[model samples]
Target: MAENYVLRTQRLLSKLPFSSWLFGKVISRRAPYFGTITPRITQVIPGKCECLIRKRRGVENHIGTVHVIAIANGLEMAMGTMAEASIPRHLRWIPKGMTLDYTAKAGSDIRCVAEVDQSAWQVGDMPVTVTALDDNDTVVVKGSINLWISEKPSK
Candidate 1:
Protein backbone atom coordinates (compact mmCIF):
# COMPACT_ATOMS: atom_id res chain seq x y z
CA MET A 1 0.00 0.00 0.00
CA ALA A 2 1.15 3.52 -0.67
CA GLU A 3 2.03 5.69 2.30
CA ASN A 4 -0.35 8.50 3.18
CA TYR A 5 1.09 11.80 2.03
CA VAL A 6 0.14 13.67 5.23
CA LEU A 7 1.67 11.00 7.45
CA ARG A 8 4.80 10.69 5.34
CA THR A 9 5.33 14.43 5.25
CA GLN A 10 4.81 14.75 8.99
CA ARG A 11 7.43 12.06 9.65
CA LEU A 12 9.94 13.56 7.24
CA LEU A 13 9.57 17.12 8.49
CA SER A 14 9.68 16.08 12.13
CA LYS A 15 13.32 15.12 11.64
CA LEU A 16 14.35 18.51 10.28
CA PRO A 17 14.93 21.88 11.91
CA PHE A 18 11.99 24.28 12.10
CA SER A 19 9.61 21.39 11.42
CA SER A 20 6.50 23.27 12.55
CA TRP A 21 7.18 26.05 10.09
CA LEU A 22 7.68 23.54 7.30
CA PHE A 23 4.47 21.77 8.15
CA GLY A 24 2.51 25.03 8.13
CA LYS A 25 4.02 25.95 4.81
CA VAL A 26 3.05 22.62 3.32
CA ILE A 27 -0.51 22.97 4.58
CA SER A 28 -0.80 26.52 3.27
CA ARG A 29 0.30 25.39 -0.17
CA ARG A 30 -2.38 22.76 -0.24
CA ALA A 31 -5.18 24.86 1.25
CA PRO A 32 -4.68 28.57 1.02
CA TYR A 33 -7.69 29.45 3.15
CA PHE A 34 -6.36 27.34 5.99
CA GLY A 35 -3.31 29.59 6.10
CA THR A 36 -5.46 32.36 7.51
CA ILE A 37 -6.07 30.36 10.69
CA THR A 38 -2.39 29.45 11.17
CA PRO A 39 -3.23 26.03 12.51
CA ARG A 40 -0.67 23.78 14.14
CA ILE A 41 -1.25 20.07 13.73
CA THR A 42 -0.38 18.57 17.11
CA GLN A 43 -1.44 14.99 16.54
CA VAL A 44 -2.69 12.75 13.75
CA ILE A 45 -3.45 9.04 13.66
CA PRO A 46 -5.78 6.62 11.96
CA GLY A 47 -9.00 8.10 13.28
CA LYS A 48 -8.14 11.32 15.04
CA CYS A 49 -6.35 14.66 14.63
CA GLU A 50 -5.77 17.57 16.96
CA CYS A 51 -4.89 21.12 15.93
CA LEU A 52 -4.27 24.39 17.70
CA ILE A 53 -4.78 28.01 16.67
CA ARG A 54 -3.48 30.92 18.63
CA LYS A 55 -5.77 33.82 19.38
CA ARG A 56 -4.46 36.76 17.42
CA ARG A 57 -5.65 40.12 16.20
CA GLY A 58 -6.14 38.81 12.71
CA VAL A 59 -8.58 36.19 13.90
CA GLU A 60 -10.48 38.31 16.37
CA ASN A 61 -13.97 39.62 15.87
CA HIS A 62 -15.29 43.08 16.71
CA ILE A 63 -15.93 42.00 20.30
CA GLY A 64 -12.32 40.81 20.78
CA THR A 65 -13.36 37.20 20.53
CA VAL A 66 -12.00 34.68 18.10
CA HIS A 67 -14.06 34.91 14.95
CA VAL A 68 -16.35 32.05 14.11
CA ILE A 69 -14.88 31.66 10.69
CA ALA A 70 -11.38 31.30 12.06
CA ILE A 71 -12.53 28.58 14.41
CA ALA A 72 -14.24 26.85 11.50
CA ASN A 73 -11.04 26.95 9.51
CA GLY A 74 -9.13 25.35 12.32
CA LEU A 75 -11.81 22.71 12.68
CA GLU A 76 -11.58 21.96 8.99
CA MET A 77 -7.82 21.57 9.22
CA ALA A 78 -8.18 19.07 12.02
CA MET A 79 -10.80 17.09 10.12
CA GLY A 80 -8.78 17.15 6.91
CA THR A 81 -5.71 15.87 8.66
CA MET A 82 -7.66 13.05 10.26
CA ALA A 83 -9.24 12.09 6.96
CA GLU A 84 -5.88 11.98 5.24
CA ALA A 85 -4.45 9.61 7.80
CA SER A 86 -7.55 7.46 8.23
CA ILE A 87 -8.64 6.84 4.66
CA PRO A 88 -7.13 3.83 2.97
CA ARG A 89 -4.65 4.49 0.20
CA HIS A 90 -7.08 3.10 -2.33
CA LEU A 91 -9.73 5.57 -1.17
CA ARG A 92 -10.00 9.30 -1.80
CA TRP A 93 -11.92 11.88 0.22
CA ILE A 94 -13.17 15.41 -0.27
CA PRO A 95 -15.03 17.66 2.14
CA LYS A 96 -18.59 18.01 0.90
CA GLY A 97 -19.93 20.44 3.49
CA MET A 98 -19.78 21.50 7.13
CA THR A 99 -22.23 22.47 9.83
CA LEU A 100 -20.99 24.37 12.86
CA ASP A 101 -22.48 25.71 16.07
CA TYR A 102 -20.86 28.28 18.26
CA THR A 103 -21.52 27.38 21.84
CA ALA A 104 -19.50 29.91 23.82
CA LYS A 105 -17.18 32.86 23.65
CA ALA A 106 -13.62 32.05 22.73
CA GLY A 107 -11.39 34.26 24.82
CA SER A 108 -8.15 32.35 24.37
CA ASP A 109 -6.22 30.10 22.08
CA ILE A 110 -8.31 27.28 20.65
CA ARG A 111 -7.70 23.57 20.25
CA CYS A 112 -9.75 21.57 17.81
CA VAL A 113 -10.15 17.82 17.84
CA ALA A 114 -11.64 15.74 15.02
CA GLU A 115 -12.47 12.07 15.12
CA VAL A 116 -14.02 9.37 12.96
CA ASP A 117 -15.21 5.84 13.58
CA GLN A 118 -13.44 2.97 11.87
CA SER A 119 -16.76 1.43 11.07
CA ALA A 120 -17.72 4.58 9.24
CA TRP A 121 -14.95 3.97 6.71
CA GLN A 122 -16.61 3.21 3.42
CA VAL A 123 -17.32 4.58 -0.04
CA GLY A 124 -19.99 7.08 0.81
CA ASP A 125 -20.68 10.26 2.67
CA MET A 126 -18.97 10.20 6.05
CA PRO A 127 -19.84 12.64 8.80
CA VAL A 128 -17.00 13.47 11.16
CA THR A 129 -17.41 15.36 14.41
CA VAL A 130 -15.07 18.12 15.50
CA THR A 131 -14.98 20.14 18.68
CA ALA A 132 -13.10 23.30 19.48
CA LEU A 133 -12.13 24.00 23.07
CA ASP A 134 -10.94 27.17 24.73
CA ASP A 135 -7.98 27.48 27.08
CA ASN A 136 -10.21 26.45 29.94
CA ASP A 137 -11.18 23.27 28.11
CA THR A 138 -14.67 24.59 27.52
CA VAL A 139 -16.33 23.72 24.26
CA VAL A 140 -16.62 26.84 22.16
CA VAL A 141 -17.54 25.31 18.86
CA LYS A 142 -18.99 22.02 17.69
CA GLY A 143 -19.23 20.95 14.08
CA SER A 144 -19.79 18.13 11.68
CA ILE A 145 -17.78 17.77 8.50
CA ASN A 146 -19.35 15.74 5.73
CA LEU A 147 -16.86 14.15 3.40
CA TRP A 148 -17.43 12.35 0.17
CA ILE A 149 -15.33 9.20 -0.11
CA SER A 150 -14.69 7.08 -3.18
CA GLU A 151 -12.17 4.77 -4.74
CA LYS A 152 -8.98 6.30 -6.00
CA PRO A 153 -8.52 6.52 -9.73
CA SER A 154 -6.31 3.83 -11.26
CA LYS A 155 -2.91 5.02 -12.38
Candidate 2:
Protein backbone atom coordinates (compact mmCIF):
# COMPACT_ATOMS: atom_id res chain seq x y z
CA MET A 1 0.00 0.00 0.00
CA ALA A 2 0.97 3.62 -0.48
CA GLU A 3 2.62 5.18 2.53
CA ASN A 4 0.87 8.47 3.06
CA TYR A 5 1.31 9.29 6.72
CA VAL A 6 -1.02 12.26 6.56
CA LEU A 7 -3.90 10.06 5.44
CA ARG A 8 -2.98 7.40 7.95
CA THR A 9 -2.93 9.86 10.81
CA GLN A 10 -6.21 11.36 9.72
CA ARG A 11 -7.82 7.93 9.63
CA LEU A 12 -6.52 6.98 13.05
CA LEU A 13 -7.08 10.27 14.83
CA SER A 14 -10.49 10.90 13.32
CA LYS A 15 -11.93 8.04 15.36
CA LEU A 16 -11.27 9.80 18.65
CA PRO A 17 -13.42 12.44 20.31
CA PHE A 18 -12.74 16.05 19.40
CA SER A 19 -10.49 14.65 16.73
CA SER A 20 -10.94 17.53 14.31
CA TRP A 21 -9.80 20.09 16.86
CA LEU A 22 -6.91 17.90 17.90
CA PHE A 23 -5.88 17.36 14.30
CA GLY A 24 -5.92 21.10 13.69
CA LYS A 25 -3.56 21.67 16.60
CA VAL A 26 -1.24 18.98 15.32
CA ILE A 27 -1.16 20.48 11.84
CA SER A 28 -0.65 23.99 13.18
CA ARG A 29 2.21 22.82 15.32
CA ARG A 30 3.85 21.37 12.22
CA ALA A 31 3.17 24.52 10.19
CA PRO A 32 2.83 27.38 12.63
CA TYR A 33 1.53 29.85 10.04
CA PHE A 34 -1.75 27.97 9.80
CA GLY A 35 -2.42 28.82 13.45
CA THR A 36 -3.24 32.39 12.53
CA ILE A 37 -6.87 31.58 11.73
CA THR A 38 -7.11 28.57 14.03
CA PRO A 39 -8.66 26.38 11.36
CA ARG A 40 -10.49 23.24 12.42
CA ILE A 41 -9.94 20.24 10.12
CA THR A 42 -13.41 18.79 9.99
CA GLN A 43 -12.79 16.08 7.40
CA VAL A 44 -9.95 14.43 5.43
CA ILE A 45 -10.58 11.79 2.81
CA PRO A 46 -8.99 10.90 -0.48
CA GLY A 47 -9.33 13.89 -2.83
CA LYS A 48 -11.41 15.95 -0.41
CA CYS A 49 -10.95 18.00 2.76
CA GLU A 50 -13.29 20.16 4.81
CA CYS A 51 -12.29 22.87 7.28
CA LEU A 52 -13.93 25.52 9.43
CA ILE A 53 -12.95 28.88 10.86
CA ARG A 54 -15.02 30.83 13.34
CA LYS A 55 -15.77 34.53 13.01
CA ARG A 56 -13.53 35.50 15.88
CA ARG A 57 -12.07 38.87 16.73
CA GLY A 58 -8.61 37.94 15.60
CA VAL A 59 -9.89 37.03 12.13
CA GLU A 60 -12.15 40.04 11.69
CA ASN A 61 -11.43 43.02 9.50
CA HIS A 62 -12.14 46.79 9.74
CA ILE A 63 -15.72 46.38 8.56
CA GLY A 64 -16.48 43.58 11.06
CA THR A 65 -16.20 41.06 8.25
CA VAL A 66 -13.87 38.13 7.96
CA HIS A 67 -10.58 39.12 6.43
CA VAL A 68 -9.81 37.79 2.98
CA ILE A 69 -6.34 36.74 3.99
CA ALA A 70 -7.65 34.87 7.00
CA ILE A 71 -10.09 32.96 4.83
CA ALA A 72 -7.33 32.36 2.29
CA ASN A 73 -5.16 30.91 4.99
CA GLY A 74 -7.95 28.57 5.99
CA LEU A 75 -8.49 27.57 2.37
CA GLU A 76 -4.80 26.89 1.92
CA MET A 77 -4.79 24.72 4.97
CA ALA A 78 -7.60 22.60 3.54
CA MET A 79 -5.91 22.27 0.12
CA GLY A 80 -2.47 21.48 1.48
CA THR A 81 -3.72 18.89 3.92
CA MET A 82 -5.92 17.29 1.31
CA ALA A 83 -3.03 17.05 -1.11
CA GLU A 84 -0.85 15.42 1.49
CA ALA A 85 -3.48 12.80 2.17
CA SER A 86 -4.41 12.06 -1.43
CA ILE A 87 -1.05 12.07 -3.15
CA PRO A 88 -0.16 8.95 -5.06
CA ARG A 89 2.51 6.53 -3.82
CA HIS A 90 5.14 7.16 -6.48
CA LEU A 91 4.25 10.85 -6.86
CA ARG A 92 4.48 14.01 -4.73
CA TRP A 93 2.75 17.37 -4.79
CA ILE A 94 3.36 20.95 -3.70
CA PRO A 95 1.16 24.03 -3.98
CA LYS A 96 2.67 26.41 -6.52
CA GLY A 97 0.04 29.16 -6.22
CA MET A 98 -3.54 29.96 -5.32
CA THR A 99 -6.19 32.16 -7.00
CA LEU A 100 -9.17 33.35 -4.99
CA ASP A 101 -12.32 35.31 -5.87
CA TYR A 102 -14.24 37.22 -3.20
CA THR A 103 -17.78 36.85 -4.40
CA ALA A 104 -19.73 37.66 -1.25
CA LYS A 105 -19.28 39.28 2.15
CA ALA A 106 -18.07 36.96 4.81
CA GLY A 107 -20.35 37.91 7.68
CA SER A 108 -20.24 34.66 9.62
CA ASP A 109 -18.17 31.57 10.25
CA ILE A 110 -16.64 30.00 7.14
CA ARG A 111 -16.57 26.43 5.96
CA CYS A 112 -13.77 25.74 3.50
CA VAL A 113 -13.82 22.74 1.22
CA ALA A 114 -11.24 21.51 -1.29
CA GLU A 115 -11.76 18.78 -3.84
CA VAL A 116 -9.41 17.08 -6.32
CA ASP A 117 -11.14 13.95 -7.50
CA GLN A 118 -9.47 13.36 -10.84
CA SER A 119 -6.33 11.26 -11.24
CA ALA A 120 -4.00 14.04 -12.25
CA TRP A 121 -0.81 12.86 -10.65
CA GLN A 122 1.26 13.08 -13.81
CA VAL A 123 4.32 15.28 -13.86
CA GLY A 124 2.62 18.59 -14.39
CA ASP A 125 0.39 21.19 -12.82
CA MET A 126 -2.93 20.10 -11.33
CA PRO A 127 -5.58 22.51 -10.19
CA VAL A 128 -7.68 21.86 -7.11
CA THR A 129 -11.01 23.59 -6.61
CA VAL A 130 -11.67 25.23 -3.26
CA THR A 131 -14.66 27.11 -1.93
CA ALA A 132 -15.40 28.99 1.26
CA LEU A 133 -19.02 28.95 2.37
CA ASP A 134 -20.66 31.21 4.89
CA ASP A 135 -22.95 30.09 7.71
CA ASN A 136 -25.87 30.36 5.31
CA ASP A 137 -24.10 27.99 2.89
CA THR A 138 -23.30 30.81 0.50
CA VAL A 139 -19.99 30.87 -1.30
CA VAL A 140 -18.15 33.85 0.10
CA VAL A 141 -14.91 32.96 -1.64
CA LYS A 142 -14.04 30.61 -4.48
CA GLY A 143 -10.73 29.65 -6.03
CA SER A 144 -8.34 27.07 -7.37
CA ILE A 145 -4.95 26.08 -6.07
CA ASN A 146 -2.34 24.99 -8.59
CA LEU A 147 -0.15 22.13 -7.45
CA TRP A 148 3.10 21.05 -9.01
CA ILE A 149 3.18 17.27 -9.15
CA SER A 150 6.42 15.38 -9.49
CA GLU A 151 7.99 12.03 -8.76
CA LYS A 152 9.42 11.31 -5.34
CA PRO A 153 13.16 10.81 -5.29
CA SER A 154 14.42 7.30 -4.81
CA LYS A 155 15.51 6.41 -1.28
Candidate 3:
Protein backbone atom coordinates (compact mmCIF):
# COMPACT_ATOMS: atom_id res chain seq x y z
CA MET A 1 0.00 0.00 0.00
CA ALA A 2 2.77 2.40 0.98
CA GLU A 3 4.59 1.42 -2.17
CA ASN A 4 1.57 2.38 -4.24
CA TYR A 5 1.48 5.80 -2.64
CA VAL A 6 5.14 6.32 -3.37
CA LEU A 7 4.57 5.28 -6.95
CA ARG A 8 1.63 7.62 -7.29
CA THR A 9 3.68 10.46 -5.84
CA GLN A 10 6.44 9.72 -8.29
CA ARG A 11 3.94 9.66 -11.12
CA LEU A 12 2.55 13.02 -10.03
CA LEU A 13 6.03 14.45 -9.84
CA SER A 14 6.78 13.25 -13.33
CA LYS A 15 3.62 14.73 -14.76
CA LEU A 16 3.20 17.99 -12.85
CA PRO A 17 6.66 19.52 -12.69
CA PHE A 18 6.19 19.97 -8.95
CA SER A 19 8.71 21.67 -6.73
CA SER A 20 10.00 20.25 -3.47
CA TRP A 21 7.10 21.82 -1.61
CA LEU A 22 4.58 19.90 -3.66
CA PHE A 23 6.62 16.74 -3.34
CA GLY A 24 6.76 17.09 0.42
CA LYS A 25 3.02 17.54 0.74
CA VAL A 26 2.36 14.21 -0.95
CA ILE A 27 5.16 12.44 0.89
CA SER A 28 4.19 13.70 4.33
CA ARG A 29 0.42 13.31 4.01
CA ARG A 30 -0.87 10.71 6.50
CA ALA A 31 -2.98 8.28 4.50
CA PRO A 32 -2.40 4.90 6.12
CA TYR A 33 -4.31 5.38 9.31
CA PHE A 34 -7.47 5.97 7.32
CA GLY A 35 -7.55 2.28 6.27
CA THR A 36 -7.28 0.99 2.71
CA ILE A 37 -7.54 4.43 1.20
CA THR A 38 -6.42 6.05 -1.97
CA PRO A 39 -6.31 9.74 -2.84
CA ARG A 40 -6.21 10.51 -6.49
CA ILE A 41 -5.56 14.09 -7.53
CA THR A 42 -7.54 14.21 -10.73
CA GLN A 43 -7.18 17.81 -11.79
CA VAL A 44 -4.80 20.70 -11.21
CA ILE A 45 -5.38 23.31 -13.83
CA PRO A 46 -4.45 26.83 -12.80
CA GLY A 47 -6.61 27.77 -9.82
CA LYS A 48 -8.41 24.50 -9.32
CA CYS A 49 -7.71 21.14 -7.72
CA GLU A 50 -9.98 18.11 -7.60
CA CYS A 51 -9.42 14.97 -5.58
CA LEU A 52 -11.37 11.87 -4.62
CA ILE A 53 -11.33 9.55 -1.62
CA ARG A 54 -12.96 6.16 -1.31
CA LYS A 55 -14.75 5.66 1.96
CA ARG A 56 -13.55 2.77 4.08
CA ARG A 57 -14.41 1.52 7.53
CA GLY A 58 -11.79 3.70 9.12
CA VAL A 59 -13.54 6.76 7.76
CA GLU A 60 -16.92 5.66 8.98
CA ASN A 61 -18.52 6.89 12.12
CA HIS A 62 -20.43 4.78 14.66
CA ILE A 63 -23.54 5.16 12.55
CA GLY A 64 -21.89 3.35 9.65
CA THR A 65 -21.71 6.58 7.70
CA VAL A 66 -18.74 8.61 6.68
CA HIS A 67 -17.49 10.63 9.62
CA VAL A 68 -18.01 14.38 9.43
CA ILE A 69 -14.54 15.26 10.63
CA ALA A 70 -12.91 12.87 8.24
CA ILE A 71 -14.66 14.46 5.30
CA ALA A 72 -13.81 17.92 6.60
CA ASN A 73 -10.16 16.99 6.88
CA GLY A 74 -10.24 15.70 3.33
CA LEU A 75 -11.69 19.00 2.18
CA GLU A 76 -8.88 20.84 3.91
CA MET A 77 -6.40 18.51 2.30
CA ALA A 78 -7.75 19.28 -1.16
CA MET A 79 -7.54 23.02 -0.57
CA GLY A 80 -4.10 22.99 1.03
CA THR A 81 -2.79 20.62 -1.57
CA MET A 82 -4.04 22.96 -4.27
CA ALA A 83 -2.44 25.93 -2.58
CA GLU A 84 0.88 24.14 -2.34
CA ALA A 85 0.75 23.37 -6.02
CA SER A 86 -0.57 26.76 -7.17
CA ILE A 87 1.71 28.94 -5.10
CA PRO A 88 5.11 29.61 -6.56
CA ARG A 89 8.26 28.11 -5.15
CA HIS A 90 9.57 31.45 -3.83
CA LEU A 91 6.65 31.72 -1.43
CA ARG A 92 5.61 29.75 1.63
CA TRP A 93 2.10 29.13 2.85
CA ILE A 94 0.49 27.88 6.05
CA PRO A 95 -3.08 27.34 7.14
CA LYS A 96 -3.76 30.32 9.40
CA GLY A 97 -7.40 29.53 10.05
CA MET A 98 -10.41 27.53 8.86
CA THR A 99 -14.16 27.24 9.21
CA LEU A 100 -16.36 24.25 8.41
CA ASP A 101 -20.03 23.73 7.70
CA TYR A 102 -21.50 20.28 8.20
CA THR A 103 -24.51 20.62 6.01
CA ALA A 104 -25.45 17.03 5.31
CA LYS A 105 -24.89 13.46 6.37
CA ALA A 106 -22.32 11.58 4.37
CA GLY A 107 -23.56 8.07 3.77
CA SER A 108 -20.95 6.81 1.35
CA ASP A 109 -17.55 7.48 -0.12
CA ILE A 110 -16.55 11.09 -0.86
CA ARG A 111 -14.93 13.43 -3.31
CA CYS A 112 -13.34 16.79 -2.50
CA VAL A 113 -12.79 19.62 -4.91
CA ALA A 114 -11.17 22.98 -4.07
CA GLU A 115 -10.61 25.96 -6.29
CA VAL A 116 -9.33 29.55 -6.20
CA ASP A 117 -9.42 31.94 -9.16
CA GLN A 118 -6.48 34.14 -8.29
CA SER A 119 -4.32 34.89 -11.29
CA ALA A 120 -1.12 35.79 -9.48
CA TRP A 121 -0.04 34.90 -5.97
CA GLN A 122 1.83 37.51 -3.96
CA VAL A 123 3.22 37.27 -0.50
CA GLY A 124 0.51 37.92 2.04
CA ASP A 125 -2.71 36.28 3.26
CA MET A 126 -5.64 34.68 1.53
CA PRO A 127 -8.62 32.38 2.09
CA VAL A 128 -9.74 29.38 0.05
CA THR A 129 -12.73 27.11 0.45
CA VAL A 130 -12.64 23.38 -0.07
CA THR A 131 -15.75 21.29 -0.34
CA ALA A 132 -16.50 17.61 0.15
CA LEU A 133 -19.44 15.76 -1.30
CA ASP A 134 -21.00 12.37 -0.73
CA ASP A 135 -21.73 9.77 -3.36
CA ASN A 136 -25.14 11.28 -3.91
CA ASP A 137 -23.51 14.66 -4.59
CA THR A 138 -24.65 16.42 -1.46
CA VAL A 139 -22.20 18.57 0.39
CA VAL A 140 -21.03 16.84 3.51
CA VAL A 141 -18.61 19.51 4.67
CA LYS A 142 -17.17 22.73 3.44
CA GLY A 143 -13.93 24.13 4.86
CA SER A 144 -12.55 27.59 4.37
CA ILE A 145 -8.85 27.65 5.15
CA ASN A 146 -6.96 30.84 5.82
CA LEU A 147 -3.54 30.75 4.26
CA TRP A 148 -0.54 32.87 5.21
CA ILE A 149 2.06 33.30 2.52
CA SER A 150 5.59 34.55 3.11
CA GLU A 151 8.59 35.12 0.93
CA LYS A 152 11.05 32.29 0.51
CA PRO A 153 14.82 32.44 0.02
CA SER A 154 15.96 33.64 -3.38
CA LYS A 155 17.38 30.87 -5.47
The top-ranked prediction according to lDDT is 2
Clashing pairs in 2: none
**What tens-digit string does per-residue lDDT give for candidate 1 at 31-69?**
899898888887877899988889999999999999999
The Cα error of candidate 3 at residue 93, in Å, is: 0.5
User: Residue 37's C-alpha lDDT in candidate 1?
Assistant: 85
Give the C-alpha lDDT of model 2.
0.90
Whose TM-score is greatest here?
2
Comparing 2 and 3 on lDDT, the stronger one: 2
Candidate 1 residue 28 Cα shift, in angstroms, is 1.6
Instruction: Provide the RMSD of all predictions against the true structure, rounded to 1 decimal.
Output: 1.6, 1.3, 6.9
Candidate 2 versus the native: TM-score?
Answer: 0.94
Compared with the true structure, what per-residue lDDT tens digits does model 2 show for residues 1-155? 37478777777888999888889988888889999998899998878999999999999999999999999999999998888888878888888999999999999999999999747667899999999999999999999999999999999
lDDT of residue 146 for candidate 2: 97
TM-score versus the correct structure, for each prediction: 0.92, 0.94, 0.73
Off by over 4 Å in 1: none
**Ten consecutive residues with minimal summed lDDT in candidate 3?**
1-10
Relative to the unseen true structure, what is the C-alpha lDDT of residue 111 in candidate 1, on a scale of 0 to 100? 93
